[model samples]
Target: MEMHIRSLTKPDGRQLRLYSRHPIEHVENAPSPFPDPLHANPHMRWHPLRGEWITYAAYRQGRTFLPPPEYNPLAVTRTPDNPTELPPGDWDVAVFDNRFPSLSLEAHHPPETIVPTMPSTGKCEVVVFTQDPQSALGKLPLAHIELLLQVWAERTLQLGRHPDIQYVLPFENRGAEVGVTLHHPHGQIYAYPVVPPVPGRMMQIAAEHYSQHGRGPLEMLIEQELACDKRLIYRGEHAVAFVPVCARYPYEVWVAPIKAVPSFVELDEEQRADLARALKTVLMKYEALWNRPFPYLMAWYQAPTDEQWHPEAHLHAEFYPPYRTPDKLKYLAGTELAAGLFAMDVLPEDKALELQNVTVQLEEPAHA
Candidate 1:
């Protein structure tokens, strides 16, 4: 697969990196109808009480909302009448800089206030999985999924190498229930300047576990899940997907590498393929469970770019679906929001059994 790379400098001076498997027709002076306002002055404030970094991107309030199908920005430009983000052509997979990014490459000096604050200096990009806007990741072929994984790994490695970035997160928010503003089948990659609270806490806990048990928490957890075999959903050669014992959501599944790997870039070809299969199985089960499209937040947790924090970290993908049943949606109530306490209605083992019994019919081709 020959990939042609090109760079486009937007009118607002933001650079968009374009990669495609086929030749890209260069547009000399394409008019950008929606020019960036250049008002994103994001800053991170230290939450002294919670000991976490709180990012404030007020400019994101004006981001593209639920637009009509004709105004889908992620779709390929088929005619001059509709000029999307990508060049006017079809693409297997395409990635470019996000127009309304949470963070920016151009660091800014925050205001001088009593509260501790720093400029949100990082990067954000949109990864378009397919040219067909109607398709979802679960419905894509295995080969396409594998290629998407490769793209994720490449982006992780590239973004993690930046000195300003501390953590690189690739995540997808599917369906309107999951707060998806766009209907297109795509994901976003966020390179954070500082490690987020959840991952930071997890890293600390894993380090403590390693100090006591002399093994990573992820490795131990995987071993225990495999031994119990009750909550395990799908066990591949190199990866495993299971409903965690203390699952906060009704159908939450944690997909992790059997081996102790720090990030996706460490995965070999076999491991990547196994991960693709494991992810597909879980997604198919979700689709079958409701007999409708499954809305979920697919989040990838990787090790921090700092090498010192690498040994204790492990790569994992977590699915947080809001639906408790076909018509019911689980909303984070007071306890969950105020106290950070989760209330799950279903037991993990029972949910696992229910998912295991679900029969998934794959109508799409497995491979390209």
Candidate 2:
């Protein structure tokens, strides 16, 4: 049987060729602006990277996952005098593996416990963007923000050398409403022996796309988006940041290199620095939205250490936050809890324009 695909343009203008039997239903003002569940949005999305299309449809639920207030307690707090205990100050970007780790670091195939016996060894790290009690990404200086970007690239290269690790996912979480467990300005990394489901699905779809169409998925996306510039947030010599047409989250921004490269280690120094500058610029814009520490989840996508089938992989990063208005936020409800489909209320274009900005105040330092 032949597979049928439907091409559609999202509200923001990201071109999508959704795989389906019949043509996709295009509503006049669908997902119409209202208080909808998170799952109502696209379960996954794709873009041009390296030479393939990567899918992360199932992760849309993550945008509005239930909040466990217990995670961020209000018992005793830590002060500048002692940061290791109770609470932590906003910090310079710090890198560390995930503790509530979804994947293990070393394969211990001894007995049965939570998950089936699969050697799921991976790495997770956090990058604290500031050291102030009240500081957000937009409130950081160009120097400090640049430093954070440098650290992200440097860490990606360091983890790519791990023999057992296959994929390295560096991401951040902000805003208590977004279900952030910790209040610090930080992001995390997950280096796994196998690529996650989302990226894997994208690689699979790209395989089909490659067999039928002779071009890279992300390559095409870059060309198409650059030509339109509707959702195009910013473009640099090596990178482009945009809010995808079918964005699952309220304000979702993806930034990736124009040319397909699967790993940060493959990026030249100048290219890496360019990425850093772009990151700082974009993040500062995120903070300027509400002048508070806006909650966000940022991640860097790179090749798995085991460079097998790398032709199917592409490299990029993203920032997806659920905060709709400065004070208003999107919450996860029943539909999203049971099913994986996401429902976004506001249009992607308005959300991106609302969040994107250049004016911000930096967090104070010792000299200040």
Candidate 3:
């Protein structure tokens, strides 16, 4: 499949990169309406106590809220009167620059202040999973999910090559409880100029473990989970998904490649397929657990792009579902928010058993 690429410079000087498997003529004939001009004033402040960068983008406050269905911006445009972000046509997958990005490549210069600060020179792109806005990721066919995975790997490789970007994160926020402004079934890719805090701390721990032992911490964790067999959800040939022994959320699941890989770009075709299947299985189980649309945050943890290549760093995806029961949602309060400590109500082993009991249902292809 040939992907046609084009760049458009928005009125606010931000560059939008468009990627589509369809012909360029299709996109040109039905160009999407330009979004309202909005400038991003992004800057990163040094957190002296935490020793991490704190990004602030004031313009994001005016982002589109929960608009009505008729005005869904992420939907594929069907008519010129209702043009969305995507051009009017059938597209297997589409990617474009985010209208209200928290970070941008064309961010304004940082002002002089007593505290140290730097320009938030990064890129944020939206990954539209399907042409149909209402379709969810788990409901889509395995082929479409595989295509989405390919796009993610491509973007990871492309964004990681940038000299300024230090970390490339691909993630999804589903449902309003996860703070999703749009109801579309989509995800996002954030290329951070600096390594984020969570991954930074993870790399540090992994490095310490590697120095103490020969193998990486992720490999050891997978082996331990397999040995226990209680937390193992799905074990594929190339990938494995299991609930961590120390899960932070009630239904938290970690999916990782059996063989250590630093980033999605390193995964081969077979590994990608296996990872997709493992991911789909976990997502399906989540919905089946409550027999409703599950709300969760899917976060991909990949190695940084900088020269500090930690051999112990392994690629993984973590799911943090808010629901602890059918109607109960886990809210992060005092202990978790202020003290940075998690208190789980359900045991990881029991949750894993519950997920393992749920059967996987195969669905027909929703998109080509």
Candidate 4:
């Protein structure tokens, strides 16, 4: 898989990168809506009881909200006067520095707090999935989707090289119910100075499991799921998607490679191809379930970029849809919010069956 990339500096001194499978023929200078350079200085405060860092970025409140269709910021710049984030190009995907980042590499000057405080010297980047604002991730061509996976691998490698960045997370929040301010098909990457609490706990558990059994918990679970043939959504040669036996959400689904691949960069060509199909299968099922665009939070988990070999870490994607039923939503209550325990009304098997019933047809990979 050969990927052509071009990097440019926006007017605001932000980095913009354009990627495509084919050689990029047309190009325009990158533009920014904001004329001034970024002044991002986020800080992290220690939570004594929780044993975690809480980041505070007051500028995020002023980020772009649900703007009118005419003012879509992710759209390609149409005129010189009306500039958008992306320039006119033949790029399959675009990535740029977030104008209102929660964490920044330029962050400094920790506030004088009683508790521990430090500069959030991390990175935040926005990934525009496509030039078309109307299309969704699952709707893209298989080859295009594969390119995205490659792009993610590239980003992980680039961000992980920074000594200050210990972990990198790529995630997407779709629909207004999930507090998606922008209707554009996009996602964000957050590189952390230290491994966050959730991933830290997950890594600890995986490490323990690996030490005891010589395999990660997710790897063991995948074997059991494939053997049982129950709660399986998509079962490809190199990858699989299913609802876990211990799913926290009613319609939760997980997509992963059959092998215990640690991160995006570790995915082989066959694994990457099959993983893309598995992802598309689950997403298409979500939209077909209700015959409308589905709303969900998709997060990818992988090994931390702390310059350590992690045989315990397994690469996977988790989908947490907001809706339990067609018209009903699964709202988090006291137990879920306060106590961190989730109570599901429906069974994981039933939800799996529901998704299994929805049929989706995918087209072959496209090439020019």
Candidate No. with top TM-score: 4
Q: Candidate 4 versus the native: TM-score? A: 0.97
Query: What is candidate 4's local distance difference test score?
Result: 0.92
RMSD of model 3 against the true structure: 3.2
Q: Candidates ranked by lDDT, best first?
A: 4, 1, 3, 2
Per-residue alpha-carbon lDDT of candidate 2 for residues 43-73, written as tens digits (9 for 90 to 100):
1122333333232223333544343544332
TM-score of 3: 0.91
Worst-scoring 10-residue span by lDDT in model 2: 27-36
Q: List runs of model 2 lying over 4 Å from the truth.
A: 1-93, 97-102, 113-115, 130-134, 143-147, 210-214, 309-312, 334-337, 355-368
For model 1, the stretches where C-alpha displacement exceeds 4 angstroms are: 1-7, 18-33, 36-39, 62-69, 361-368
User: What tens-digit string does per-residue lDDT give for candidate 3 at 256-303?
Assistant: 998788888778878887888888889888888878889999999988
lDDT of 4 by residue, 111-199 (tens): 98999999998899999999989999988888888999999999999999999999999999999989996888999899999999989
Counted clashes in each candidate structure: 0, 36, 0, 0
Task: Quote the lDDT for 86 in model 3.
Answer: 67
User: Of the candidates numbered 1 and 2, which has the greater TM-score value?
Assistant: 1
Against the hidden reference, what TM-scores do the models get?
Answer: 0.90, 0.65, 0.91, 0.97
Model 4 residue 295 CA deviation (Å) reads 0.4
Q: How many clashes in candidate 4?
A: 0
Give lDDT for model 3. Answer: 0.80
